[model samples]
Target: MSQENLELLGQSIAPGESRTVDFSMAKLYTTTKVEIPIIIERALEPGPTVLLTAGIHGDEINGVEIVRQLIARKMNKPKAGTVISIPILNIFGFLNAERAFPDGRDLNRSFPGTKTGSLASRVAYHFTKEILPKADYCMDFHTGGASRFNAAQVRIVAGDKQLLELAKVFQAPFTVYSGNIRKSFRSTCEKLGVPILLYEGGKSLESHKQIVKTGVDGVCRVLDSLGMLQDQFVKPPLTESGVLIEKSRWVRAQRSGLLHVKIKCNKLVQKGEFLATITDPYGTMRFKVLAPNDGYIINVNHAPIVHQGDAIFHISTQAGSI
Candidate 1:
């Protein structure tokens, strides 16, 4: 169960060896080393390598929990290839319990970065240069920003038959067609020819049990398909692929007031159905929000107050079966 000369980030890793590599790039203001621990597990038989990551946005605790559960359950110990789990990629952001880097930059937006760039960009630079090249596929966990709660879903760009197939295999609740942002990690992975499946679930700063379970189960299914899943773990039964969301739009609050949601996320609603109510502080004014069309409610705003133009829900305008 050992292969010779498997080098990663200038360190030699023998096959079947489990190692935790502390990636040190910079130091804090107190001169403390900022180390990002990368947990790796390799199998004796050579096959594809999969990289699993979370915490690009520090406040998205559900994503972090999903990756944590995978490691705690020993799911990363692959049977054929290697599994690399970086549970907290943005250590700086995580320490502060903030979404962005200490410098106010979103780490997810810094990709294929430069050595002399901002802190986030520099971290991205080293990761892109040293670690990402080894991954044949990648799964990056994420969640809805702030108080927006998203249904467990996998986001993939349109027209890539291969990635779409993998998304189906993962079997999250939904598979959404989304365009990659410029300079985002998903974009960089595409440029490097590495297929990536981005998962979104729950809301920031919270860990939902159902979300974590969905994510962990999806990863197992993907590994099993790749022949990397271990024999000890029971292979998960294939479920219907996530509902393919071809097009979706945000349903904004029509008036500024204290909002009350009447339905939960992932619920199917008919057109003109009551979704929420907005009321004024004086108790003199009330406004009812209705579904614009028949679609699934994929996201919901958990915040109690909303402005006139704030987005309160994400409804799929078009959906199809795989």
Candidate 2:
């Protein structure tokens, strides 16, 4: 039963049968009627069900574009097992070019949602009840929010050894071992024993062609590892000494001014290295920003303007590697 053979009522797909499930809106002029477009492709052979989702945070454009390209490419050559893709989960935010919903709610933070709470909560509820339970593995795409820039990396939540192994197959430049944050989609999914890998790259409001290629390649590599795709399509590289950071800290600005940063994100920095300088009007006074420790810059604010106490940089030191 290939997906093409699936009835309008949604039937079980036979091995190698690829199909698209209409999660689209049933009505107009209402968020309640909007559908979360899903493409569920089941292979001819039985394999693990992996869910690839993007636009959890609507402002992140790289992941959204990557998912789009992936689906366009994958549809031509069907993979073995089932792959459920949600390319644009936050349609409202994506349409508005915003990070949150129209109600100013973050869908990622409202996971395993309530039916009666808020719009985001209700949407989250739909995902929890409809898609996640059917998945054996998950890959959630993300990127730096607006005003922030991040290097390509995969995040495996603490205690998820199996997810870490799958992330290893992705072979992203950086592998960050992160802990679960309360109410996060990963945290809620963890409660259900669903291991997930979080991949972050590029930045909001912009797109990187190379990063997009890497992301698509990485997703294919994971599917290959899970036996969903042909094994020889992509040969994943070995990550060279990925940093397993337990925690990261954001460096805050001391004053409001125009920020001139000297270092780049994802670069290794020595202790006391000049990171940036904040210049006031007339350039009379400048506050120098220095590295707090010897570590790598995982993320940094790209916007030149900043307020006092605003996070300007995010750094993490490898355990005992510093």
- Best model number under lDDT: 1
lDDT of 2: 0.78
- In the range 258-277, model 1's lDDT, one tens digit per residue, is 99999999998999999999
lDDT of 2 by residue, 175-285 (tens): 787877877889888999988888899888788887788788788878767666764466456546556566678889998999999988888888899999999989698
TM accuracy, model 1: 0.97
Residue pairs clashing in model 1 are none
Stretches off by above 4 angstroms in model 1 are: 1-4
**What Cα-based lDDT does every candidate model obtain?**
0.93, 0.78
Candidate 2 collision pairs: 1-14, 2-17, 3-18, 15-43, 15-44, 16-43, 16-44, 25-35, 43-80, 80-228
